[model samples]
Target chain A: MATTEAARPIAVATTPHRRTRWRHVLTGSVVPRVILIVSCLVFLAPFYWMVVSALKTNTELAQFPPSLIPGAWAFNNFPDAINYIPFGLYTFNSLVITVGATIGAVLSNTLVAYGFSRIQWPGRNALFYLCVATIFLPYPVILVALFDIFGRLPSFGIQGAKSWVDTFLPLIVPAFFGNPFYIFLMRQFMLGIPKELSDAAKVDGASELQTFWRVILPLTRPAVIVVLILAAVAAWNEFLLPLLYLQSNDKYPLAVGLIFFTSEHDVSYNLLMAASTLIVLPVVIIFLVAQRFFIEGITVGGVKG
Target chain B: MTAAATSVKPRSVGRFRLGTLERRNLKWGLLFISPWAFGFIALGVFPILYTFFLSLTRYTGFRSPTLIGFNNYTTMWNDPDFWKAAYNTLYYTVLAVPIGVVVAMLLAIAMNQKVREVAIYRAIFYLPSILPVFAISFVFVVLLNPGYGLVNLLLTTAGLPSPNWLGDPAYTKLALVMIAQLGAGQWALVFLAGLRGIPIELYESAEIDGAGAFRRFRSITLPLMTPVILYDIIIGLSFGLQVFTSAYILTGGATRGGAGPDNSLLTYVFYLYQQAFQFGSMGYAAALSVVLFLASVILAMAVFRWARGWVFYGGEEA
Candidate 1:
């Protein structure tokens, strides 16, 4: 049951408020510049510590007031770290999971967001709010039963548990249905998309799906990339879920696998830091390259929430 | 198009009157969002409800759950380790969230300062937050270790006594709180956005009135940023309460059952994992989850209620 749909609303950016020319508070000066540099360096210290420790010998690491820079850079540390675990295998597993999940999220989020934005339904707004509120469904509570669901896959008994446990399925499968945060972000982004394009397609006798795929999806590349980056970064660095589900080393993602290294060789700070670098490098690169999308996604999606 | 759409109106007889185009939109909307709708129920709603029931009974990966109402709850109430973990978690949340938010906001304001190559500086500052927590945890473990850790080295050089960070239960959580800033980058970005969202006119007018930077910040910026602060607190509360990976990794908890020295670093999630997995007390863990969920819900409600008085909507919806 529904009434005649209203005209599509164009999302307005906040109107610029009138200026009242005021003196600058934080004027660029020697004092502020020095403070800025010092702050940046302080933040960079941890990464420096990681890299420095990674290149140090065990004895060097053990020294009080550990060497700021290693006597000799241990180029072997990265190789050693990888050799210590099935590092390649873990990387592969992490990639498969992150990539698959990103793809799944992109598909699910766009479609669902389109439904909310372009289509009119009696329960659309209510359901969308319901979806958004589910953002707070702490997974810890749900995992108790979710683990049980995975354990017994209907006809398949404990035997299927092998594939379920220690496999990438747990993290990747859920992405096929949109995550609430990404969906919210995508929906907000989609809200700004001019509806005339879709209406014109409708006038041309295009189906809703065609309008979504051809008209909406193409225009929403920025939104898609935003969701993809969010999904990918999250899926990549995720720790607890993988730790809980992955029982074996071979199936472990870097987050889980790296910790396994720490527990086993607890004192090998060199190898530990090297592996830390390895694990962090990809995300750092992704973040740096896609800074705009990531920044916009959080600022817009998060502020509203 | 109007004629064609109108022709399709009479097919479905419904209690409520509907336009033809509206009916089509309803069909397409439902059809398009079915996957998410299915997922919301299967993944979110049903599991939460099931967990609530599961919390009431004893079950350890078994299909059947025998009801023993209030028993699991009472058991957790009487559990010392649970209390220790709860205290540890609260200590962290209280210490970390407010400090983290303030620091993040300050950093945001600092970054918002008009400067050249500010983008690069911003990226560098924000990089740590993007790094995996586990990786960062491991680095901090070595960095904060009393013997060879860089943290102790720096502190000692600064003429401060170095506490055994990970080993001393007294300092384990404090150490985590300090390192929590490593991930404050995301919060800072949000703050920066909030700073940007503040119309420059506010600051300009305040300055025109001879208000100093600090006064301007207090009178205008801080008030406007209350909503963002509310957002930051909510995010911080959730993450702070559920802190696991850093605790688990830094304490060598995977090997040590997630209990740092004297069980000091045992956060709520760490304790939850131990209950369900280590002790084979899945039901007890479920009960723990229920407690955490309820506590988080209550605290969030309180925050939202409190926020109402101060959160300046600035013409936006509350």
Candidate 2:
């Protein structure tokens, strides 16, 4: 910031061509502006095509030189798509897992973060390193073992030996444990809170938990919001887990459900795109709503994105 | 409150006993992270160790896993499909990671410019990436559908022959590379974040030295952004090696269990999934994952070694 201004006067004096180029481009530069506009359209075209194709009738969709815009918007494509596939049940199952796991994740990650950050304890650094190390442990390795464990998570009322396969428990239950990335993100965010707030709370006879619950969590709503959206989006888009455990279509998430829809309704581009759009809606909306926080989380959260 | 009355400081006391307050904090700390601690023991530690053990055993889902020695590893070594999957994974990673990073870096630089309403453009660029990975895969399946697909239509109109994307073995991985590049916005944002971090003053100082934009970029922007670029490359490589859903969805894995034409899109994780669940070869899948984990470590070590002098850090050189 100091540099932008300090350098600006010098830049104007030193490079008249550069200043003119900036000014010219700001007004109208055919090449750069064209590139910018074209790239914008390129990014946007897929979405436009998805929406347009979703609304097209099969006849219109079959056209050789496809109409840029659908001649007739089949609004019923959504309903038809939902009816054609078991999207509603799949969506409901996905919702349950997303909400259940998100709630579990937020609570677990925040609580664990508070422990790691606010209250410095013996072996905390070592324990924290242990948590961070899990970030590198590829999901596929643990997945082979997790399947067996989940297979053993005793069936409550169902008959025969327990299997987490074809059930929602495996998908929803792990969020309660704590995700390494979320724990790390929330921990970093919590560490930024001044020590004096917790100190003052301690002096007033508030317990550590009380200080954390009342003082820290509230102050870190932004981080919570970030973690919530990240976790929820992750749950929504998770294909592999839902594909793994949820054997039946009744238990499939949107991600898995959409794939099933595509294969079942092959060549029905309209319906497939419609279903795809619906699956993606929640994630795009959440990111739009909390754009800054989402980006901030990524910046701090590092790569598990 | 009364803990301060104890005439002791942790630093001052060389090897003193644990203070009451320290013990209390420890208790609460343990209590706070108890969920993760239990979970790690149950889930993290158990699963990792069990996976290693399972790799050496014949564990189909229904039957009890029998100790099979190094059979699973040896089987994978001999399997033709395993080699194919490994080769496909390597091909995808080598192709995708570099292109993805460069495209994202360029996009970030362009988006970093002082333009009006650049936020809207940034948001637009980022939307495709943030959209569920499978959704983009679904969309691309439609957009790239050989004959009647929009991509082919455009190509033919321009008098360019459009290859059968998901159909031909030759084009399947290339098609995936294109799909992967389209969603480079996530890393682009990371690069944008890095680009924004570069102080404007550095450019001005360089500009005062009569450096051209290209020279300034090379001298100032490129060096500063190396760390983020390296990070972006590493993340891209990991994801590239693990590529699955795009191939699975695009090829319609449900109807046909094959990845793509002749399994060209069969990545490491994809093959692992197929082996464990579809083929019920859980032990074999475990071995594949063990190889993958080792590969990831080796890859990171290679990149770190490669980055020794190249990746610039601010305070270190100064």
Candidate 3:
């Protein structure tokens, strides 16, 4: 801030006082526009570097100070990186796994959350508390238990088939069962809705399912979208689950794929950056488009703190 | 004619009484919620039960189970590393949660300072939050790199010695703690929303009473903000305890078997991962997970109970 002022003084002196004040405000404040620009640079530099490095030759990558900008972006790096691994196969695998998991999570979580929120039933609090309690058990503790159960027996009656844990079922199946986090979010959003509407629907002889489908689902679109987005992002970015369950490299998600890529290579920074860039591109695009709802979902999803 | 027409109204198709329809609706509602009911039994109940059962056994992922009740838990009680992981996690929790919350609140206050391009600043801070953990980890790895990294460069230029960040055992956990602060923009935005929800009249009355900024904040804003703070702390603790991606990636995967440099960064989850997946100690891993789960539950319950005294719902009087 002080440096920006020091850099341009004559213009400040010659300009109208209002203009000078405005300049000072934008350029010299705590969160000055300049600071914002620099932070954005910091925020964006890695992705930019990744793109540039992905384009650079192996020779250019090791150069001192690293090329801030590539001389000639080796577009071939994209194909080359993909070729090094079963990139196409992995991409398809990730999409299938992520999509299936997301759909399953949304359906199950929403239904469960609706039950917890609006539907009165026996053992409701105890059941809901049990769901909430599940959030605390970190993946490590459950991994062994889950493996024990799924690893031995055919998962979900897929017996005589290859072991279920080695395949994609375990990754996607839990989502359909609903996650505790998504349930909390759904229930919170449901509270914002007027109960009178549901009552009116009930008075009209609409069954609970009909009301949920025709009314609650439509009204809770924002929450639903946010949940779906979160689920997709989580599933897409998941490493541990796939790492545990997936034996074949072809079954890896992008997170695992990028890691495997780095592990296989001889620490080629440029190639690693390229792969990381590809790994994050879909998430960045999706988030940028849906940022508003995403933020809303988070704030509203949280316990109003 | 209008009165007569208005008075006469009974649809023969429907039962107008409440009791009959109410019972029917209750049954239907339960039926509609059956998917969740089934899920609770299958996904929720069974896994928890299975975990408890597994904890008392000695089953690896590859092997058949053998009963060894309470041995895994008892062994963990004696293990110094378990204590280390707990201490490290608690160290992180103590340092990160309060500091993160305070910084977020301060940042939100700064952001609400009637400035132009608030949205832009908000987005700039938020960028890190949305980035994949690996990307942030990679950038920090470069930024925190000893000699050539930009942070060190700036420190040296300013006539300060640059600390070895990720490499030093002393600083590894601290470095992880610092990295947690970077993506604080998301939390700041959350705080900003919370601050906005606060009615302006509270501030107005405080000002009218000649309460200065600090006093106003102390007397009014802080109390009103307790619920949100409680919320943030609970969420942050759970997430922070499970800190893995940064450590896992930075330490070159779990094949290294633990967090780097004398296990300075070996959080419980990291240790649990090593046991279950890397070492193939499924039973031990399940025990560790169950214990960790119990710990988190205790923390969560503590927060909720503490909140009853401090957190003011809008309708509740102080």
Judged by TM-score relative to the true structure, which candidate is superior, 2 or 3?
Answer: 2
lDDT of each: 0.79, 0.80, 0.72
Model 2 agreement with the true structure over B34-146: per-residue lDDT tens digits: 99998999988788788888889988877788999999888988999999999998998899889988888877777766555677767777777667767777778878877
lDDT (tens digit, per residue) of candidate 3 on A1-305: 12323445665677757775675565345554444556557556555655666778877765544546778777778777777777788888889898999899788877877887766555667867876766654545456667666676565545234668777888877677777778878888887889888767766766678778888889988888888988888788777778778776666777677776556436655566667777788988888888876687667644211
List all candidate RMSDs to the true structure: 7.5, 2.9, 6.7
Instruction: Rank all candidate structures by their DockQ, best first, as comma-separated numbers.
Output: 2, 1, 3
Q: Single out the weakest 10-residue window by summed lDDT for candidate 3 chain B.
A: B1-10
Locate the minimum summed-lDDT window of 10 residues in model 1 chain A.
A1-10
Tens digit per residue, CA lDDT, model 1, B103-196: 8887777777656566866777777776777777888888887887877877888999999999888899998897787767667788887787
TM-score (all chains, Cα) for each model? 0.91, 0.92, 0.84
Best by TM-score: 2
Per-prediction fnat? 0.58, 0.57, 0.30
Ranking of models by lDDT? 2, 1, 3
Q: Say which candidate scores most in DockQ.
A: 2
lDDT of 2 by residue, A83-166 (tens): 877887878888999999999999999999999999978899899999986675567667878898888877674323256667
Q: What is the DockQ of each candidate?
A: 0.33, 0.54, 0.26
Per-model tally of clashing residue pairs: 0, 0, 4
Residues B1-318, model 3: lDDT tens digits: 222322345334556443433444456556655776676677656777898888898977665779998999999999998888888788877888888898778777666554567777676667667667776576566556685455666678799988988789888777777677766667878888888877777877676687866897788778878878887888787877778777777776743455888888887778887888778888888888888878887887888898888887777665
Q: Give the winner by TM-score: 1 or 2.
A: 2
> Model 3, A196: alpha-carbon shift in Å?
4.3
